[model samples]
Target chain A: MTPRRILLGAAGAVVVVGVLEAVSRSGLVDETSLPPASTVLKEAGKLAVDREFLVDVGATVREWLLGLLLAVLAAVPLGVLLGSVPLLGTASRALVELCRPVPSVALIPLATLLFSSPAQTNMSLIFYACLWPILVNTLYALRDVDPVAKDTLRAFGSSTPAVLWRVSLPSAAPFIATGVRIAASVALVVLISTELLVGGDNGIGIYLTETQQGGGRTDLMLAGACWAGVLGLLANTALIALERVAFRWHAARVEGIA
Target chain B: MLEISGLGHAYGTHRVLEGIDLKVGEGELVTIVGPSGCGKSTLLRCIAGLVPPTEGKVVLKGAPIDGVPDDLAVVFQDYSRSLLPWLTVRDNVALPLRRRGLGKAERRAQAVKALASVGLEDAAGKYPWQLSGGMQQRVSIARALAYKPTLMLMDEPFGSVDAQTREDLEDLVLQVHRAEGMTILLVTHDIDESVYLGDRVVVLARNPGRVRDELPVTLPAGRDQIGTRADAEFVRLRAEVGRLVRGVVKDSEPPDATDAEDADAEAVATAVEEPAKK
Candidate 1:
């Protein structure tokens, strides 16, 4: 990003904060329901070092990572298999279309009944939420592989498996990484939602629940939300950095086109 | 040696090629020239074992072809799409060598040597996209050369480049063909290209694509883009092939004359004999 863009973004954030601060302190909203922006920021800063809060953050991150990893491990191969084999892809189309659109949050009630522990319930919901993006991205990426490249390898006497390994997989990898990055953010959202709804043993969502139940602390609730937003931002930034480093050729091609 | 007889192909009910019979002796260069939609590419694909003909068979050295043969390579018309962009030039040239059961170092060494032959050794470490269109086509040719195939098929290989680059690539093909002494069958719609590069030019008719005629190229084996193309024999053969491709009657022959195929074949044969008789 350019320094000018960074400066503009910071200015936008400050303006938003200033508006929130004014609206809260001017009695436009009830003090108990809407904490001042300064109070929320202070509380968020304190929570950054709060040991109990840190534990909840760690638990949420761990669950998000685990669920996203499982989804990628399961989805990439399944996507490749479906993409390479036309008959199998056609056979599974009905089932995939049916499952892909149902929101994972709506499955929280079923997950709770199916799994014995809170962690299990959250993990299953996270996996379900993260599966489709990675799968669909991989499928489209494989379809988009350069047909001539595949034919060239085949004409050189390369086997089907060799063609897929040498050409299809590498061509699809950048898209698959993009899919995983998208799934990572989705996993975090679902993990926190499940934790809040199911009251997981230790998580940011569970901590937010504690603040609501203990004294209805508006500052603490907003601070918890701020952390969730921060975590998402951090994860996305890290994954984008990784993509740049790993797929320099893809990036160069994209830049050339643009 | 390679032999194809009574070969025919159809995509579902739409017929693409019909009754194609051709032979390529060892160490010979044959060029197939035709108009668009003549299924020249399909015929090449059939011989490469990529597409199965609906009728007849392709025999290579006494064996009926079932799948892509190990001792064959193809230089496609589209160099940009044919070469993998992710790999460096050296890697792309070496990729097919894995089938030869060579180790990494040997593959790299051979790839470098092939690049040098194509005069692209300095660009070995660069990606395919980093090079110009002409340079990329050279890399693809180098890749095919490194494979050391017994039979090499080129499908309109220089159809994309500018005229100057096209000449350079044509000479590169001749250089490699002469140096390696491999059987080469090149297909193109350009009548001049066919006469310029081939030891023999096989012309195909468009509708239900079939072989129209085969004219043996009598030009000197040592050819240059400038000297060879300006030769009298080259001019005569090109015009002859051009007329055959456009399915036009010779200026000396009447337009209303029937039996166009027999008349054209007989006239071309007579024209081919007159020079040798002198």
Candidate 2:
């Protein structure tokens, strides 16, 4: 990241906090319902020291990571299969269309009923939400592979599998990385939301619910929400870093095109 | 040695190649030239076994090729896509060696040697896209040379390059062909190129593509871009090839009296003619 970008980002953060602090201190919409920036930060610091709160954070992170890995492992091969075989892609389009729009969050209630365990329920929803983006992106990326590249391999007497490994996968990697990045943030949102809806044993959303139930600790509740926001931001940043490292060629290509 | 007889191809209802016959002798450099859309690429594709011919077989060393052969390599026109961008230049050149079960060190050594032959030893660590267009095409050629194929196919390998680069690449190819003694079949739309690089230039007509004529090039063995172009024989051969390629013959009579004989006679005559002596 550049110094200029850091300065701009800091400025944006200050403005957001300043506006929230003004609203809270100005007696607009009840300060009790919405805590000020300073109060939220203080409570956030206090929560950081709480062992129970840390446990909740750990549970949420574990579910999110595990669910994401499962989704990736399942989706990538299937996506590659569909992408390579045109007939299969055409046949599966109807099924994909039907399933893609069915919200993963909407399935949370059904998952809750079926799993009989809060952790499983949250994991299942995270898997459901994250699967389609990775799968669809993989499919599109493979489809978008340069025909010239495939032909080059074919002309070289490469077997079909060799063509897939050498030409298809490398060409489609950046797109797959993009899909994974999108899924990261989405998986986090789904994990926390499922925990909030289905009442996990320990998670960020469950922690927020406990804080709210205690009453008059609006500051603590806001602080927990702030942590979730921070986690989401961090996930995006981490993925961006990973993308840069994993795909220097792709970045060069993007720079050349620009 | 390679031979193609009555080779014809079509895409659905449209015919691309018809009644095409060609022969490449051992250590021969045969260049195919025609106008755009004359199925020059289709001919190479058929010969390379990338696409099956609808009506004929491509026999290499008396064996018909049903698919890509073990001892063959191709250099496609689009250098950017021809190379695996993810692989380093050395790895790209070394890929064919993988099938031969060579160890990693041997493959790397051979790849480096091939790159050096193309004057690209410094670019071994670079990706294909990282190099200039000319350099990328050199890498493509290096890859083909690295394979050590008995027969090499090039499809307008210099078409995407600038004129100076094109001349340089043509010279590099001629040098490699001489050093390696590899039989090369280069397909191009450039009349001067076809005459300049080939021992024999095969011309094709459009629509249902067929061999219009195969003109023998009678330029000196030692060729330099400027000196060769200025040579009387080179100028005549270029003009003859250009006219034949454009289907512009002043007389309907065949240029060579020997062409009146059987197909085999024509093939033998071309195989025997030293195009450089006229």
Candidate 3:
């Protein structure tokens, strides 16, 4: 990002905060119902050092990471298998279409009953939610691999697996990285949603629920959500940085085309 | 050695090639020239064992072609797409060497040697996308050379480059052909390229493409673009091939001025129309 763009973004944020603060101070809504931006920002800052809130953040981040890792481990191979083998892709097309659209949140009650631990429940939901984006991206990326590149390897007498390793996998990697970034965001959302709905012992979602119970503290609830947004922003920025470093060749070629 | 007889192919109901018969001795460089839609590439693909012939068979070294042979390589027209962008030039060349049961170090050494042969050793550490179009094509050629295949197929290998680069690449092919002494079957639509680069030119006619004529190039082995292309024999052969390619000589009738025996040395050297300059 350029300095001017960053300055513009910060300016936009300041305007938003100013507008929210003005609306709250003018009594457009009761303070109890809609906390001022300054009060929420203050609570959010204090929660950064609060030990109890730190534990909740740790719980949420841990679940999100582990679930996302598992999804990557499972879904990438599955996508490659299906993408490389047309017969398998055709055989499973209907099944994939059937399962992909069912919302993971709708499975919360079933997951709570199935898993003995709340952590397991949260992880399963997050894993399910994160799987599709990574899998679909991998599938399409493999489809988009240059046919001439594959044929060049084949004409050199390279076997199928070698072609996959040397050509298709590397060609698909940038798209797969994109999928992982999307999945990271999805995983965090699912983790928080599960914790809120299932009432986990320690999580950002659980803390928000407790704030609601304790006299409906709008400031604390908003602060907890603000931290969630910051976590997502941090994760996205880190993943983008990783992609830029790892897929520099992809970036250069894309720039050349543009 | 390679032998193809009665080879034909069709996509569904659209027949692209039919009743083709050709042979190439070991260490021979043969080029196939045809007009567009003549299935020249399809013929190469059949010989490469990538697209199985719908009619007949290809036999290489006494073994019938099945899948892609164990000792074969192809340089495609679209070099940018043929070379992997993710790998550096050296690694792209080295990747095919793994099929030869070579270790990583051996592969790297062989890849570097091949790149050096193409005068691209300095580009070995750079990604394919980092190089210019001609350099990328050289990388693809280097990849093919690194494999040390018994048979190399090229489908319009220089079709994408500019005229200057194309001439340079043609000389490079001649140099490598002399050094390697491997069998090569190249397909192209450029009639001049066919006569300039081939030991023998096989011309094909379109509409269910089939072989129309084969002319042995009598040009000297050590050829330069300017001197060889301007030679009298080169001019005569090019005109004849152009006429054959354009269907000027009817399929049933033969040109009366030329005979098959001692034709290169004593064919009608005079009264031949010069081919239009490019």
Candidate 4:
């Protein structure tokens, strides 16, 4: 991006923040109930200084990462199997459709009752939320692989595994990356939501609930929300960077298509 | 040598090829030309081992080909999908060599050599989508050349390209054939292209894809696009091949009517000359 574009984006962000600040300060709404940008920023600064906030962030990050890794381990191979074979894909579609629409958050109550531990419950919810995108994306990507490329590999006397590795996997990689990126933000949201719902040991969500209940410190609560937003932004940006670095060809092709 | 006899295929009761027979000698270029939807591609697929013959078999070097053979390579019509987009041009050319256990340096060297053969050496690091349609097809051809197969099958490889690029690719194929000394079987719907490229052009009739006729191209050994097309013999062969392809005969009868008309025409002409002399 050009520096001019960057400056324009920054200007746009500032204008939005300025308008929000003006609305909150004009008494159109209760400032205490919905804190202004300035108050939230100040609280954010204090939270950054607090070591407890760092620990809570660490716990959420650990759970999110562990859950994401587990989802990948379980989803990728299964997705490939479902994608490669037509008959199996047809047989499994019913089961996938059955499980896909039931939101992961809806499973939180059952997860809490089953797993006596808060961390396990949170991890389970994250896994549940993250698996579908990864699995579905991978399956679609594999299915989208060019049949001509597969036939070319087959013409070279390549085995089934060889065709999958050399043609299907590489072709499907961009879609898989897209899925993972989506799942990253979703996993984080589910992780924090699970903690907030189930009353975790120490998480940003628990801290927000505590702050709200004690003195109705809306700024502090908003500060925790701000951190969640920042985490989500950071995760998305990181995945975008990884995608650009790893699949430059795919990115260039996408830009061309666009 | 490759021999295919009694080759028949069908897709869920819609028979495409039936009782088709073809024999290709070593280092010969045989082009199969037919009308659209005549199952020429199906015949090529059966030969390439990508599609199985429902009844007969394709024998390669005296062995029945049940699947794709190691010594055969195919260039598909859709060049965009034939080459893997995720790989660079050089890597795409070098892909078939990966399982051969060639070292990285050797693979790159061979890929570069192959690209140079197709006049695409500068495009080694570029992705397939980075090149034009012609260049991408060249990359696919480079890949086929790099594989160095004993036999190469091309299914309307130039159909998707522009006219100018089509001519250029045709000449490149001729050059590659000269250099590689590999037998090639090309399937095309373009009658002139089949005559121009093949040592012997095979015409396939529609509605079961039986062999219509086989025309021997007796053009001079060396050929250029302009000079070859301008030659009298080339024109005559082209017309003859075109007539055969369109199912046109001098007798104004169906092709299966046989050569009895030719003998009858000769007898009538002799009788007319005798009357003129009297």
Candidate 5:
């Protein structure tokens, strides 16, 4: 990215915020419903130093990270197995197709009733949401592994496990990384949604629920949502940067394709 | 030494190669040349045990090869796909050295030597994708060299590079073949390449791929691209291999169509389930 691009991005963000601030201040809408951007930003600043808010942020991040990690652990190996074995892949295709589209957010009530702990409920929902992207990406990436690389390894008398470890894994890694980045955002959304519905004690969603319950403090509610959005944005940016650095060759190849 | 006896292959109704028999001596470089889609690659795969021929068996030393032998290596033409893009050139070259029980330091040491042999010593740290197409192919060849296989198979290894790089790579293979005394079987569609690189050139006919003719190269060892190609004998041999590969010898050849059909029938008489695709 160039300095000029960064400058323009900053300017664009300021313009949006200015528009929101102006629209709110103009009294075109009731202040109680859509709090002025300045007032929300002021509350958000206080949130940066508030110990309780910090704990909420930490809890949200922890749940998101844990759920994503578990999903990746379960999905990647299972994806590789199904991807490599034609029989297993064919066997499970119907089941996967049926289960995949049922939204994890819709499962919140079921998960809340089934799991005793709030963490368990949050984790279950987040895990459900994060699994599909990672699994499908891993599966397709493994299938798309270069045949020549596999053949070259085989010609040297390398075993099946050797070829998988050396060729298939490396070839699939960039795709896997992209999947994880997508899963990270999905996990955050699911985590927050689960907490909001289940009424957790320490998460951004909990902060929103509590603020709304405490005589409808609309400023605090908007501020909490702002922090959550910022967190997602920062995470996505970092993950994108990491992908670029870790898989430069894959990045170059993708650019060439585009 | 390698012996292939009456080998035939088919994918359902699609017969790729049929009734092929050839013998290769130890430490000899043989090149197979023919038109496109002649199944020359399939023959190489069969010899390497990467793909099993439907009929007969390939015998390496005294044992019939049921799987790829430990003393075999292959250099494929599509270097962009053959070499792992994530690994450094040194690691790519050293990859086959694993399962040999060599320590990391030893593998790198051998890989460095192989890279130097191909004039890629300075590129050891770069990824295969970072190199030119020709340099990437050299990395593939360097990898095969580092494996130190008793037999090496190359499938049009220079096909995708520029002409100058192709010549350089051809020389690199010849240099390695002579230095290591490894038996090499190269498949090509280029007639001049077959005459230039092989100790003997085997021309194959398309459609039911089978050897049409074989000619021993009498050019002196240590050939150069300029000198050996200009040799009168080289000119004659290339033209001969070219004519044979182009199906020009079909008429003058003895009428063996019935014999070929009989052989094909016997080979497919006990047909069984098709083997899994490699």
Candidate 6:
């Protein structure tokens, strides 16, 4: 955007921080419970270099990336199968509808019982949460591919697989990228939430749980959450940049459609 | 090199095309003109193996064509839909070459040459959407030309462009046909277009589409819009084809109109249209 817009955006953040600091410091809220904004900011800064916190960050990033990658692997092919084969999609519709909306967090009991390890449990939870967006996006994108383009390829004697590979896949790629970007956020949420609730062996979520349980360090809990939010923002920005660079024409087309 | 005999197609219980029998010898440019619902596009689809006929079959070069033949290319009317928007103009042209097992360099080189042929050399790097309607259709033509297909099927390929662009595209096809002698079958509803492009024009009637008449165009080759269209032969042939497509004729009108009117009605029940033999 414009430099003025960027300056205003930064000013907006400052105003928000200024208001919170005022409220927290004026004794409007008890410092023992709220822990002034400055205290939280100081904890967040210190946690940036804290090796334990760094490890926690690394663990969460690893789980988020791994879970997202696994979801892509499972969902893309399934989407293609269901998207390309009408009969297969019709057959799977009932099962997909039944399973898609059930909150993934509710599956923790089943995952813990089935998987005997916490890492597996975290992976399963994130995987379940990330799968729907990627799969559904892929299915719809493939469906949205231009039929005439596919027919043109076929008229040149390209087989069904060739048409899919050459036309349908590339056409659906931008949508797939969007799905991945969305899933990156979803995976992070599920990862951190599962770690918090289940108290995994070592994770940002578990670390946040430790901060609260070990004498209630609310600042550390908030700081850790702040770091998680930063990571999610950074991941999404990178994925969006990747999508722009790789699919410029698609981006233009999407904007036109929008 | 292409033969369609007793070809009929019905989508569900609704028959769209029936008894469509025509043949194009090697190097012949045959155009089909018909009313809007005459299933002209469906006929092209059947010939290209995009759709199969329910009645008779399409035999290309002595083989019963059940699927899209390896040496055929199609230029659809909707260039926005036909040309892959994600690909640059050059890449879209080169895409059909992938199945031919060409290397990257060769495909690019051939694609560039094809783009040059279609007068789109400078547009190679641009996306199809960045260009005007005419240029987008040119990219579609370039894609078809790059394939080096033995037979080309164009379904109202210039229908979306402006009149000037349409005429230019028509001339480009003629120039390409003269240069490569590629057997071509073009379907259009524009009566003048059929008369101008084809060595022979096949006209189809609507309501379970069937061939109405086949008129051999006798205008001399090396045609241009100025000299060729003004020729008396060209006017006669255009009106004859117009009569066929518009379904307006009267044997009592005049000597010129009567000749064309007499050619219709009984255009049915005729299988082998030996215009040369007649």
In terms of DockQ, the best-performing candidate is: 3
**Window of ten residues with lowest summed lDDT in model 4 chain B:** B257-266
TM-score of chain B of each: 0.89, 0.88, 0.89, 0.88, 0.88, 0.88
Which digits, one per residue and each the tens of the lDDT, describe model 6 over residues B1-278?
A: 88889999887877778888898999999998775556777788888998878899999999999888889999988788888888889999998998889999999999999999999999999999899999999999899999999999998888777778888999999999999999999987677888899999999876667999999999888899888988999888877777676672235433222212112311320111122112
Enumerate residue pairs that collide in model 3.
Answer: none
Give interface RMSD, every candidate, in order.
0.9, 1.2, 0.8, 1.3, 1.0, 1.0
Model 3 B-chain TM: 0.89
Worst 10-residue lDDT window for candidate 3 chain B reads: B265-274
Tens digit of lDDT per residue, candidate 1, span A1-258?
899999999999999999999999999999889999999999999999999999999999988998888899999999999988989888988888899999999999999999999888888898999899999899889989987799899999999999999999999999999999999988988888888888967999999999998568989999999999999999999999999998988998888779
Which of 3 and 4 is ahead in lDDT? 3
lDDT of each model, Cα atoms only?
0.89, 0.85, 0.87, 0.84, 0.86, 0.85
Expressed as tens digits, the lDDT of each residue in B23-59 for candidate 3 is: 9999999999876566777788888888889999999
Per-residue lDDT for A1-258 in model 3, tens only? Answer: 999999999999999999999999999989888889999999999999999999999999999999999999989999999999999988988988888888899999999999999999999998898889998899889989988789888888877898999899999999999999999998888888889889969999999999989468999999999999999999999999999999999999999999
Task: List candidate 4 stretches off by more than 4 Å.
Answer: B99-101, B248-278
| lDDT tens readout by residue for model 2, B159-249 | 7777789899999989998999999999877778888899999998766678999888777677899999888998888878877765633
**In model 2, where do residues sit more than 4 Å from their true spots?**
A214-216, B248-278
Model 2: how far residue B126 lies from native, Å: 1.9
In model 1, the Cα lDDT at residue B47 comes to 95
Q: Point out where model 6 deviates above 4 Å.
A: A256-258, B248-278
Collision pairs in model 4: none
Off-target runs (Cα >4 Å) in candidate 1 are B248-278
- Over B1-278, each residue of candidate 4 has an lDDT whose tens digit, in order, gives 99999998887766667888899999999998765556777788888898888988899988899888778889988788888888899999998987667998898899999999999999999989999999999998999888888999998787777778988999999999988898999987676688789899998876566788888889765788899988898788878777776663335543332222122222222232222121
Query: What lDDT is reached at residue B44 by model 4?
Result: 81
Better of 1 and 2 by lDDT: 1
After best superposition, candidate 1 residue A140: deviation in angstroms?
2.2
Which residue pairs collide in model 6, if any?
none
